[model samples]
Target: MSGSGSRTAAARAAVGAVWSSVTSACWRHWPTWAGWAAGGFSLLYGLLGLYWTAGGDGFPFAPVDPARASGSILEGSRVEVVAPIIAVLGLVGAVVAWLMTRRARPGRRSAAALMVFGWAAAIGLTVIVPDYTLIILVAFAPLLLVFAFTGVPGDQGGIGDILYWHRTNLIIVFVGGLLWATATLAYRRRARGACASCGRRHEEGGGPSRQTLLRWGRWAVAVACLAPLPYEITRIAWYLGHPLGVTPDFLRMMQDTPGMLEVGLGCALASALGGVLTHGLVARWGETYPRWIWFKAGRRVPPTLAIVPASIVAVTIIPAGLMFLWTSEARGTWAMYVPSLFWTVWGVALGVATIAYHLRRRGACRHCGQGPQPGPEPRTSLDQRQVRDDPVSAPGQRA
Candidate 1:
């Protein structure tokens, strides 16, 4: 009897140790952490948001109209009560999935699925509310959740390695945003007969001209970079006007934070300008090497180098934009929630740029490529060169 009891205790301890080790390994990777954060934040935020939206006074944004009031927080409630609970469960499940990935456990696929569902739920809540801030946050949540699950590098085949890939994508997004903003502004300016970029219209039978797009894009980048400076001024005003938790206008004032949008917009503009200028430099003057430059590669950069960054920007911007659209309440004025507009505009620009970059990289025309054209039958699963040199499988491949 004594021997049997000791054996049982030892088995339990061994199991606990294995579980801890597995969970630890899973959390070490960034993608897993991203997924975990997205899942957890969404689960918590959504359920809480849903509860309040449905009239739980404990959470903010409870239905305020006395005519529609339910006597209790849970009063007159339907299955909407289950919404937050479901969100929490899904987020918890995603965390469990991350753990299982490291442990090589059986339920990882289900966990990943649950995380996806959780993000969907979060996005749904954002749309239901549509307050500008929540819309912006929720719009970005899905991308973050997917990234959280897949971006991290590990022995697990979860999402594969995407660290560098994500970074470069960010750069491309920056470029795209600049160009799109410029184009939009220029189009508006041309319509209004202001600004040289849009001073004249394109010739007959012409779509958006290349030079027009480029010129407009440059101006867009400049405006976007400057857009955030005003917000910074607002933040300074808020700091001076309000004391912590004391102002009569607390709720109204809270909505006015300047935040980091300005910095992000600026970085994006600079990056786009740099990419275009660098390419132009290489095209015009022959290889002009700086003192720190080690290689003589000039501007003929490898396709992967460009594609990876473009992909990162795509993955980040789209989800983020979606999260914003989902979370926002439709009540506020445009000026009150200008960030949403900026994000939406920039997000679309980044997306277009991503598609264009991939199309051009695939041996299409550099100046006019939009994307892969529709055709009858497809060739192989991948191009020959891509298969031969894929970093995932090729011998001595660089990450």
Candidate 2:
């Protein structure tokens, strides 16, 4: 009985040690813990809102009668069905966020699972609430102007008009972006710490010198970045009563709409701004903060800060560009075909530039601004034997 009691005590002690370690780690990284808690709470709130909507009660902020709620062809009752699915997703996301906080590196499996879930939520919500999705996409890529202007059936409203009325979907898009960004950042952090060749902890090095490929990559990025300018200019001209390459009927239709000119002008300005930002990827300011910024001037830029958003944009735009290419080819619009090709090229170029930047910056040691220096070689057995046998003949000895 005494031996069994001792064994139980030992087990309890081991579990206590583990718990202490976890608590200590959590205390040290309290911000990460707080973020997880916030995410969980937000998800719970979303689920609650959905539940309230599903139960024939109006949402707290925006009340609508249950009979007036939109019905879904696939599920019969949109609120009743989608709310439960989203609630399940939210629960899973909350659990995953908690698990991520417990470890320094969530394994590849966890990262993959999180990515899958994030994308699923993003896509599902986009399909169900397209207006919100359109707005989010527009914010990211103004080139989506074509789709935004397309008319929706039975509503006598353009896609933009319908989206304007359904503003609640913005919350869903925001949550989806958060989930995806978190998962992606976690995965990138793990990847950065490990060596690509041996999967070992990488010591700092002056990586590859600036090569021809890198120079070409910079130029490609510049060209691709500026490619959107022509499309923007054409649209602006069309809106301003100087039609360029567009039919008179189309221009007339656009001119009749309120704020259409303003929208085109906004898209043009946004494209120009995006082009300027893209140049920073290959510029000196990309490595060291520009002097214009008082606080962060001369400070080294974090690689992930640039890489993450660029990666997301590349991933999204590449597929969209491909679809545009297919549709433009079918319609035989050479003007559209040329501009759509630029989008795909821009995505590819941005990705390449980001990779080059990472490679250039990743080699410096955090402690020293230089690559890892070679350590002194240890004496081999042969050298040791030689020194022992003839100390006088050893290097630095006078015979």
Candidate 3:
């Protein structure tokens, strides 16, 4: 029994060691090689586009039923027209991303062009090429897990419908976009004579100060918080049979529809939760965990804890929110989609807020030997307090 326990312990130790090494590698290398990753993804995606153009059966969007395609930006699109263009752009993007990967000798013209291409591709892939399917899918993930066991309700064909290839394609695009954006940011920093890791200029006066980001971050947080309120109100109103945006009959129909009201209520709740979390961007508890939970109480919150999810939601929802506005235009039901219109703003503001939060809290960069370089005095007492107690500043030691 003693021998067996020793062996088990050894095995566990080996597994833990291997896992730790793998995670450490990923953490260190992923962002560093993000440009290469983007190039690879863009190249592959472009190839896929070419395949679709060559009459692949699994073309996602175009050639779907007219009823389904009616309200989308790609409504009247054709495989022949769109696929080749997408392929060309993807190939171009791949090349641009590749070039931007390493800045061995930076020429202003070359850097400017590459920057434009990289940023454009990043924004387009994240914000334009996809739709609300990504955000909605993420939001409804819990329900999807349940549906997997119990099956989806109503005419909504099983889990396959929600997790369809087309929707999954949006996720893929979203991932590529994230890679591109990360790559572009790094490339931009390096090109502009700034630290690639922390995005701070090494000059006399560095990039935007912590205080500046905090002040603007609060404004961004406010916008992010408010943007979702309209949607939440309308969704809850519809759920409660009030029909704030639509007709009474429409509300009744929605209520009558299997799981519709429930979904609406879920969305409203999610929106409310989003607003609460967005507030956390500027909140004390956001930077440091409150003394409420059992574990990690009063600990400095990991920056990635706030950044990753917020960034995902922020970028994914732009297209999702715009879907409502575009669909309303196609169907001529502006009032019905009014609440969702602000989702675009919500996404953009949340993105800005997330960036600000990151900027404010990112204590140091190992690559650039950059600590949060101090600059001008904060405008407000609150800013002073927050800056003084910044987790990046003191780590476990609170000021």
Query: How well is each residue in 163-228 modelled by candidate 1, as lDDT tens digits?
Result: 222222223323333332332333233333333231333332333543344444344444434433
Where is model 3 more than 4 Å wrong at Cα? 1-17, 66-72, 148-157, 204-206, 294-297, 329-335, 372-399
CA-lDDT, candidates in order: 0.39, 0.55, 0.78
- Give per-residue lDDT, candidate 2, residue 207: 45
1-399 per-residue lDDT for model 3 (tens digits):
999999999999999999999997876655578999999998997898899899986666665654343233665578898889879988998899888877586899999988888888887878777777788777878888999999988777788866666667777887888898889888888887887776766674655776678778889998888887877888787777786767777778888888888887888898898888888887877876665764765556788999999987897788887877556452444435776778899889998999889877786576776776544433334344455765443345444
User: How many Å off is the CA of 146 in candidate 2?
Assistant: 28
Output the better candidate (1/3) by lDDT. 3
TM-score of 2: 0.51
Candidate 2's residue-wise lDDT over 286-343, tens digit each? 6556668867765667877877777666655554455453342325444435665566
Count backbone clashes in candidate 2: 0
Candidates in order, TM-scores: namely 0.29, 0.51, 0.85
Clashes of each: 31, 0, 0
User: Comparing candidate 1 with candidate 2, which one achieves the higher lDDT?
Assistant: 2
- Give, for candidate 2, the lowest lDDT window spanning 10 residues: 67-76
